[model samples]
Target chain A: MWDTIIINPFINLLLWIYMMVGNFGVAIILFTTLTRVILYPLTAKQIKGAQAMQELQKNKRYLDIQEKYKGDKEKLAQEQMKLYQELKINPLSSCLPTLLQFPIIIGLYQALIQSIASAPLDLLKLTRHLYPDFLKIPDLIPLNTQFLWMELGQPERLYIPGISFGIPILTIIVVITTYISSKVIAPPPQPGANDQGAMMTKMMNIYMPILMGWLSYTLSAGLALYFVVSNVIQILQYAITGKIYWGNVFPWLKKTEIKKP
Target chain B: MKNKILTIFIVISVLAISLTSCSDMNSTATSWGGATVTDSAVYFADGMQVIALRLDNGAEIWAYPEKAAANRTFLAAPVLVGEQLIIADAGNLLTSINSRDGVTQNWQFAGAKGKYIDSPLVVGETIVAQNADNSIYALDLKGTKLWAFTAEHSFWAQPASDGQLVFAPNFDHYLYAVNLETGVLRWKTELKASLVARPTLVDGVIYVGNLNGDFFAVDSERGTILWETKVAGGVWAAPIFVDGLLYFGDQTGIVNILDAADGSVVDSINVESGIVGSGVIVTDGIVFGKENGDIITIGFDGSNLGTKTVGGSIYSNLSINGNLFVVVATKGDNPLVAFDTDVKQSWVYTTSKK
Candidate 1:
């Protein structure tokens, strides 16, 4: 049960590959690349649909009809539907790929947690480790949750050597990374758009980064590692797709972008 | 418009196919040897009913609601000894119902104690019931109090005996060896880790692991530590001994084998998932449940023998009779399932069905 459900097949393959490569960061990068490749078709369809919706929004007559029928909910819906039909754009076509990625991402996160062997209570029959079992080293922190002064299993807390500050440094990094990732891909708001849809989009743009950052801090470092790698990969993907991958895109500007949200 | 209908049909067809494939992917794993050679029909709490199935033919003989009412719940497995079926209820009541008629013959534990016994281990004439209040109560076959021993913490591990002394590990990081007759603590050794499952005893060596992933081999009589090995993950399930090797599943999905004599690492296999409870050893084969609600069996050479997937987590030990295994399977999204070891559709029983 634990193996079949929590230890997802994708994570297993990636971990197996990680063991062979001896680098988790590299494993995450490769895994994300493969995931993006698998989702390419869906994303392409969504991008095309978004362009069509933008094209439809350019019609002033359709906008005027919507404004006039706004008081009548049924007439407004019919007019919107008619406009969508004329433009050949599906209203929700842009959401499918993003929605489909939710379960996969969740499964990936679960797999990483299970792989790190965290939360021993919820894990089943895993008394031994898949890796090397050190007999005399339990005295110095169980399993190496630390790498380069960062506790890989814990969110980065401010440590003063003699004091327990518990300040979440990793959370800050997560917030910054998520902000940068969203800024790189977020669609620009249309001119004279309805306030409700505009507000929703604005709220999502602001809140989603904070949510991801909070999750990065609260969850295991395996997930944090995933997020960090994912953000880097997304940035790289954007650069490549935008035809700007040949040279360094202002490193100074990238740092500023990280601080946006 | 035609495309819209086609899209809807495609969506519905995809959903139907996925659901059917998911159901069809249901398979069986290595199960406990649950079928007993005895004459009395065997029954364990599955979901809502106590399924009385023939041990010989694996046929359902009778099915009854496990509880008296829809709200009543039971925690312990229904133990069939002679003519009686001993079961523990939620209100800390131990009822010995007639096996043939399933009637109330004897009821013990008058008022509400902390919580009822999680599971009872019957050794000879004495039935050792571990209460949630960290006490082990010994009851005679007639439901009379014999003696009770209190541990430093709650006792989750089942008590095992060498036909003389009862060894039990508690949450207080100590394993106590008690005299079964007088309920006297012969010796207590601090393990530095909480024991969650019963220790596997082979020959005179007691092998037990802790929540800290430390496996120890202690001398049964002297209460002396022979050796200690640290696993990567904490062990929640009891270790099983087979062919001079000890096997234990931790909260992680790794299955480790250690030398029964010196606590040396023999071999390790990752089942790609964590196990939920201790495994049942049948000769060279081991069968256990995982937290993911799957039953897995492994052979002596670290080979995957079989697997059975269930809907709920497996919380009980597998009762082995012969080639057949019996377990309290919480199948589907529902709360109860009493099925054969083969994961066959025997009957669904719940504690709330009555």
Candidate 2:
């Protein structure tokens, strides 16, 4: 079911885009951009839902309920639910969209791997997934894996003269972009909110980039390219929404308090 | 609070990684290693070692390296040159070992940047090897680089030569003819689809098939398509020519027998399973192993001589030495099985690992 619904369509669409552009890297960027565009509304809703929940933390009634039912755990939960309903906030709204996007990310990764088809068996398996009605397999196949100095099928490395080892240039880019995207999309540290949630988020902000970098360093350059492009697009999306907290990424540039008499 | 969101993100990331790991995304073994035979031994690359089995009883003769390394993989069929066996690994290293004991390291070639998918062709004093890096390296007897012919795509099929020009089939849907000595492009004939199987060069003509179900007979002197015909399915194995007839199988399990003079289907037999490896011509008939673990023998008149189930999908071409016909399966208790002329099971060689 996953192959039929997600992987097959994604592979065919990627091939179609590759056919039109004649470049695999460009096709990846375009396909990712198109996916983000299609999911724009859900992303917007998710952002709004998260912001609303954040705002609810500062609400007077919400805080009163927390204090009033501090002694009674069950009562506190019921009051919180009532308060959420009154404010027309759904806690799951933000998470549902994120969960929905997970399949796309996984599907795209699988599709990219299939489309590359570096090995003989990989190419043979790819032939079974191709939709002849949608595109011509003969013309699109042996997809131009070469993009700049990197072969999209292999891990990217930049070889320089006299250098003993090739540098992981794409991995570095992926790490930086992932770090920046995580910080940019993160809701700014709520004043005096030293909760476990905030602590976990901070930890994730560090570990996620390292994990992404490690994956990029090990996996195919095409997937690393996808990660880099996805991160950049995410950052751009948050920036466009006027919700990006650049101060989270650049602490030195954060505005200092201007005390006046 | 926001902790739920963080927790969900963490869970999702872990799930994605777990799912990706479960998929075939990181698989390096593309296909089963083909088997090469001599008088007393049958040599093949199995996972981390090149194994030699006794031809008569399928007993272990010797294995190279002696110890298996987790980082190394040998998948291409080992080509025997004199007393040495040339083995290509997935690590882009080609090494030649003494065939007698599989201990002495003859020479190693580490110039290619891609994995060696097919066995290198030994033409006189030159070793012409096809690499997934889109180049064919021509090395000398001492493992010295001589010349290389770069193509647009990776080569899955081994190159055929007429002692002068090397005819290489590429995944770019072209059959390139390169000079055996200088590695110069003689001519490249564009087929309808990607060519995965080796082309059959007989007399002065090249017979090849493509993934588009189109078979062609191209003039070797000048790269021109003489005749083309559609088959039942996409052809993944090279066509075998015996006498004046050419026999081959397709992805749809149809074994086609055609006239070599012109591209005409003389007779065809449906074995009900896909065939990825070319068959060998036996005295009784032609023998083929299907993807469904069936070993089939068909006559020149398209009659089924005999059939036996080997219990694993056979991907490597059937290797025959004397009356022993060897078949390598993708998975089974007995991965390597041999048969006689009557399609009777001779011996089975079990792989070390599952």
Candidate 3:
């Protein structure tokens, strides 16, 4: 009874929102904002870890210690742990916020699929009874899944007749903002700039957008909209705290210098 | 970092605006087409507009645009009453337009707000229709309401009439029978799943399919289940009665022939695509138009009759006029077509209304 009355209806309400909004992209963004605001403390701890990682890079003596212990793998691990402890930094802090988003992602995905007209009946049974027939479009198609030039059920196709609506201009903005945020907030590379970590970051920087674009192409347009919107919102939140980078990389961004207390 | 935040803010502003703006601009495409065939011409509900075509040459006679923007699809094949074409829009209103010029005769019936979803069931001098909220209404030929009855759930399928009783399937998993004239509840039979297909009345039995993939024959007088046979897929398509046999297609693309007398599966054949609308037009020795977005004409011996790849799901039921079979396909580049038993195309046209 509770499943049908409570849990079922709540899930359906979210689906109703997706149907009404017509884009899963916007749905994800709104969901991210609400979650981030709720999990702000955890995100703040992550930022602190990032700040400490940056400060640790500035320690020349610490660099020497790492180099001296580098050859002895076990000893290097101990030394790194010691160094992290001394700096009051936790490595897990850096990944906690990202990991937290997983559950929300699954929930949002379930909600998006449920609201569609073609979704199976069992899955749709999870939907709430808030709007009994909210997504029931007349005649031709049963679900109102159209957004922009793209079908909300399919990936973003960039073509705007004379202009390119490709990759969802909004989604592109999200990726760019996410890239900029990483560059601004992420700690600078240490003396060993060609290290494995640096290589991984470079790979990530190139691969993530490509992956998002590919996903945008195959998956629902609603999801792409969500990614773009959430990235943009986080960027704004970071900017409020002066954590955003306004460096030469993005010459257009307004620059602000950090002054020590 | 600042640049990242700046970029993020800029992106969000754009996405938010675009998302909102895109939704405003994202009007639903009316891909569904239903035609009301008359002696002079055929009236079609194309998207939000009503288009009239000459029955002889399939030429455009007239078009009524923006008649009902409620997204109440014209799925219940158009009903022609004298010179008026009746179609339901989004359950809130039922419109009767002049069959000749596409002029509005009556737009909204008073207190008919449950949102009419099914096509009006024309019985004698009265026409009956069901709404999404399970309200059964009986209206006169001129769109005047005589009586109405509400059931336990929403109504997505068209109502079935057997002269005396109106069998309306409700989303609440019930097959309800109300008197045609008085709109009084006669009897109700609860099922395990929601009934989305319109029932076909044969003899004294109401044969209907449910969401749980079970097709049953219910006694019209007692509202008791006589026999139930499960199909592989949910029956979204209404059952079609040809002669003494019941023919219908399930969502799994299987065409089944039921006994109609005992609710026994007589013959079942699998097709390439899931059956969209109910199977119709059994000609000479062939059965056709179940699924695969194609006009499949199959021999009674279960051999391939003739197939035409019309890329789209069959959303509209087959309408037969003499030797011509009309089937409206959904989600296709070309949505409507008329063909003879030989599989030769009589006329084909595309409407962007949906």
Candidate 4:
């Protein structure tokens, strides 16, 4: 079911784009752009939901409930649920769209790997996923694996003259872009936000970049390119919405206010 | 609220990590181990290490590197050139080891930028190797590169030669005929699809098949298509010629016996499983290993002689030395199994034991 619905379609679409562009790297960029564009509405909804939740944190009644029910943990939960209903807020709204996008992300990664098959067995498996009605496998095959200096199928490295070792340039770029994207798009903590929330945000801010960097460092350069492109697109989306918190990435810059949708 | 958010992030991180790890595991070289057989022993390259075993009882003689190197993976069959056994790894390094002890450090060829999938073709003093880097490299016995012929796509199948010209089947949908001495393209005949099977040079004609199920017999000297015919499914194995008949299998698990003169199907037999490896001509009949772990023997008249189940998938080509037939399988307790012309199992070698 996953192969028919997600992987096959994605692999065919990627191959079709490669046919049109004549370059695998450009095809990947175009595919990532198309995916982001298609999910724009969901991204907007997620941002709006998060903004509303952030605003609810500053509500006087919500703060009073926290303080009033500080001693009674079970009462606190009941009061929070009642307050959520009174305000017409769905706590899961912000997470739902993100949860929905996860499959697409995973599918796209798998499709890229299948499309840039490096070994004979992987290539044979790739043939099973190709839609013959939509693709001319013979003409588009060997999919221009070379993109600039990287092989796209292998881990990216930059070899310089006199340098004995190849540098993990793409991995470094992935780490920086991931860090910048998370920091710039994250909403600044409200003045009275709980310390726990702040701590969680801080943990995510650190963990995400490291995780992305490690993945980029180990996996093929094609996926590292995807991660870099996805991070950049995310930051650009936040910038267009005027939701960027540049102050988080660069302390000298003033933070932007979360725009009401 | 904070706990839920943390939990969600943690879940996403763990899921992403798990998915990434899954891909990483799958992305490692997926080709099966290739084996080469001689009179006394069999040399097998099983991804992690290359081992030479006695042909009689499947006892290990020696393994290269002593301990398997994590960075190196060997999938191509070891090519025996005099006293040295030449093996190429997925790490883009080709090493020539002493065939006797498998310990001596031989000259290594690190010229290609891509992994070596097919074994190098030894034509006298010249070693003609096709690489995944879209180049066919010719090296001397000492591992020094002579000349390279670059193509539009990679070469997965080993190149064949008729003394003067080398016939290389490429994924670029072309059968390249290059001058063996200068590494220059004499002529290239374009096929219907990507050619993954090695071309069989019989008499003066080259018989090869493509992944698009189109098989062709091309003139070796002129690169002109002599005849073309469609098979039941994609042909991943090379056609073997015996007397006046050509035998080959397809991905649909059907074996087609074609007349070598006109490319007409004389008979077809369905084995119910895909055949990726090329078959060998035994004294009794031609033997082929299927993807379903069945070692089948078919007579020259397209009759099923016998079948023996190995219980593991066989993707590598079957190797034969005298009366002994060896096959390497995946996902079983024993990966290397040897049999005879009677389709009876002789011995099984477990790779994990070493």
Candidate 5:
């Protein structure tokens, strides 16, 4: 079922794009851009949802109700839901798109491994998954997986004489990009009754980089490349939508104020 | 409560990512060894055992790993020398089995430090075996070490011989021509990049391709690159010489017909997917395997014969035995498959997990 819906279609699309580009690295970049494009509307909706939350905070009725039921946490939650219903706002609307993207991400991860098959066994498995439409390309088989210095099929590691044994170069890129994107996507919390949410977000920001770094270090450079590209694109998309406030990110790096100012 | 749920979700995703990445690196998918087709049966390596099945029907004749003690998977293809079938795994272990009954003849372990990554070359009295490390060992028929040679990088390409000299292509971007008798280096030629394909010798010229997509026609006597041409992709499989014409495919699925006398392109054909170590077989005409599980057959004059799509990807080492062309699918519905000369399906055999 996974193959019929996601894996097969994803693999077929990846190879089809690769056939057009003639380079695996370029193919990955194109496919990632295409995915980002498809999910753009959902991303816009998420940003709009955030904007609506800020608008609701500014409303006098919402603030009065919050103060009126401040002592009773349960009543405060019930009133907030009532207000949300009046405004025709669904809090979970933003999350629906994100939930839908999980399968696509998993499918892309699987496709990256199969598409850049270095081993004969890997190639065999890939053939079984190829769609008939992909087979129509004349020079489609044996897709060249070499991109720049690294083989897209193999893990990207650089060997230095006196530095380290084998340093995963792409893995490092993935980690750095993940960190940067997290800062942009989920900035520091505003002063509100959301201390719990703030702490959880902070913990997640720290945990994700480490986890991504380990996975990137192990998987093929092709998938690592996908993560890096996708993260950069997500950050850019947030920035373009004006949802990301640059000042909120990396507050420690900000310049100290002068007395005259 | 929502925050706690989000925390759990994030934790699960992080754990899943770590687990999936680890699974990708250490893929438990059973890698299949290249097949050898005999008159009656087709033999191939699956997991730790080598199984032989009847060519006409998909009946299992015997398997080496039927016993618990003999259960060890191999990365290298099994080479049949005389009555002994030599199979080497990724580890430094070589198990010899009798071809007739699948009995364990001999097991040689700890002789080399690295695992065998390619086919064991049988050059005269010595069976030359190259490992994943930058080392090569020459063993006698009894699996005794005769001599060993080391290069600068890992030896990925299997060593080929012109009877007197053994040509070994190394990932260090050099091709060494060593004397087979003494295991002494006679000459070496540096190429555009590291070579991953087997070098073919016909008439005094050696034709080989490097990872950089450069195909070279080297003079066998002097070990000099006479002329170099370009292919579409990396040549992971060995090229076959048929009727003064060289037939080979690259990783990009481009199969080229090169002139044997001089390095010139005759014709080029592309398959549906990358050709991972698959080459052309001159049975009936030219039969080649593709990573997309398509067996593309082309006539001698570069005419399109026909293509047969199997349930699995076909390896480069497609073996021809009598009226049957046998190839194993590393992953798919059919683990072991045979096709007739007319490109018709003969039989398909599936394997049981260990």
Candidate 6:
């Protein structure tokens, strides 16, 4: 069922795109762009919602509720919901679209692994799930794996003599890009905001980059490329929507301002 | 609730990422493939699909999976035994396919631990295979287990034998000698490092190298290291002994020819790319593949005969029959490329072409 709904279609789409571009790296970029196009409306709406939420946090009533219920955790939660309802704000609007993109990311990761299959076995594994129509591409047995200086199918660690430092180039790029995107997309934590959800977001903001960096370091360069492209696109979407708060994304560069109530 | 679940997922993903040791993740497609060739056909384990192709023209006869198996992927070389092909996948399912037609399953067995990582070694009628978790199973032609061998670490290399006795290299830094008939440990010798390549039996001496780039020449009968020498890099492929001269490649892409008698380095030919696949000695000269997809052929004196780039990296062993020499470019656009003595591609078989 998953195969028909997600895996097979993704694998076939990737192969078809790969056939057109004759290179897996370009194919990945094109596929990422196509997905972004499909999800643009949802992504844009979410970005706008986040912007709204950031503005809402600056409201005097919201700040008063947060300060008044600072001691009662459950009361603070109820009051926050009550205030949001009074303001006609849907807090989930910003999250659903971000959640919607996860399956696509997982699906693309699987597709890229099989499409940029470096091993014959990996390629053979791909043959099992491919849509029958894709098999008709003529002389398309070996997809070109090279993209610039990287072998898209292999891990992207660079080796230099005598240095002994393992440099994962794509991993570093993925980390920086992911951090940049999170900064653009996430609503800035209010100065002295004592909230559970806000704390979790802060944790994600910090730890997520490290985790993503590790994945990009270990996984095939093809997947890393997809991640980099995905992050860049998300960043671009935020920039276009005018939702990016530079201070929030780059916290150290700007001092946190305590609002004058 | 949604936010809570999302936070949990983010935390789990971060944990998974931190635990990952920069190795191929469990989520990625597995990375094993090689082809074994006979006079009439070439068989490949493409991941989940096992394919049979005509050796002459790279035409496809049949492909397994006909549809995808949700939990299985064929990730290694399929051992061709007589009329049937005895193949095992990473799913712990050992299956036999009829080589003539490609779709018939004769029988199957499982190891109960994990999938087999190395190609099973075929003796007269016994098939011996090792798993990634360090268990070896010996089975008869009928898929019946005769005996099982266990070690401390994983065995990634195929077992080699001198008819009466078997030699297996383990990642636990030991080479074991087992009695093929009884399945008992005949003798065992610890090495300087983890031994991964199948031991090459020359005369009666067993030559093997480890991940530490330490190569050893062991006396097969007594199970003792006769001599050990350090090479340039890790030895991933099996060593090839041609006549009196010995040749093998390291992870650094340098092929070293050692004096088979004293384990002395006679000549070293650096291919400038990592050598992940073993070298094949053809009628023309000694030919091996580098991880960068170049097939390097050299003479006895280590002169650069020629180099040709096929595609991707080469990790599988080279299969040669007559003038048709084939190696599965297990990476990149995974294709089974056959070349003749003149270093020309005869035919290429991949999933798309067939």
| Best prediction by DockQ | 4
Indicate the docking level reached by candidate 6.
Answer: incorrect
Query: Residue B85 deviation, candidate 6, in Å?
Result: 0.2
DockQ of each: 0.04, 0.37, 0.05, 0.45, 0.10, 0.11
Candidate 4 ranges beyond 4 A from true positions = A71-75, A160-167, A255-261, B1-29
Residue A63, candidate 1: Cα error in Å is: 35
Task: Rank by TM-score, highest first.
Answer: 4, 2, 5, 3, 6, 1
What TM-score does model 4 achieve against the real structure?
0.93
Candidate 4 lDDT (Cα, 0 to 1)? 0.86
The C-alpha stretches of model 2 lying farther than 4 A from their native spots are: A64-88, A192-194, A256-261, B1-29, B305-307, B331-333, B352-354
Q: Higher-TM-score candidate among 1 and 3? A: 3
lDDT of 4 at B63: 91
Best-fitting candidate, scored by TM-score = 4
Q: Write the per-residue lDDT of candidate 5 for residues A81-110, one digit (tens) a residue.
A: 999999988877766777677678777887
RMSD of 4: 2.8
Q: In terms of docking quality, how is candidate 3 classified?
A: incorrect
- Overall lDDT per candidate, in order of appearance: 0.62, 0.83, 0.63, 0.86, 0.73, 0.76
Q: Compose the digit string of candidate 6's lDDT tens values, residues B225-312.
A: 8988889876877888887777888876789999888889999888898776677777668889877777888886788888887787
- True lDDT of residue A87, candidate 2: 88
**Which runs in model 6 stand beyond 4 Å of their true positions?**
A1-261, B1-30
lDDT of 4 by residue, A1-261 (tens): 998999999999988999998999999999998889889998898888888889899999999999999999999999999999999988878779888987887888778888887777767778888887888667776578889999888888999999999999999999999999878876788898877767776887787788788878877899899889888998999899988888887876752233434
Please give each candidate's TM-score: 0.50, 0.91, 0.61, 0.93, 0.63, 0.59
How big is the positional error of residue A88 in model 6, measured in Å on the Cα after superposition? 28
Give the per-residue lDDT of model 5 (tens digit) for B1-354.
566857656755766664475343443252445777765566777555677777678688887767524325555667887878887776667767787788767656458765566778997678888875578888888888888888876675677888998888876678888888878889999876766677887777788887657888888889988888888876777778888888888777788889877779999887657766554365567788777877788788877788777757665477786677876666677766778777778877776522
Error of 3 at A169 (Å): 32
- Ten contiguous residues minimizing lDDT sum, candidate 4 chain B: B21-30
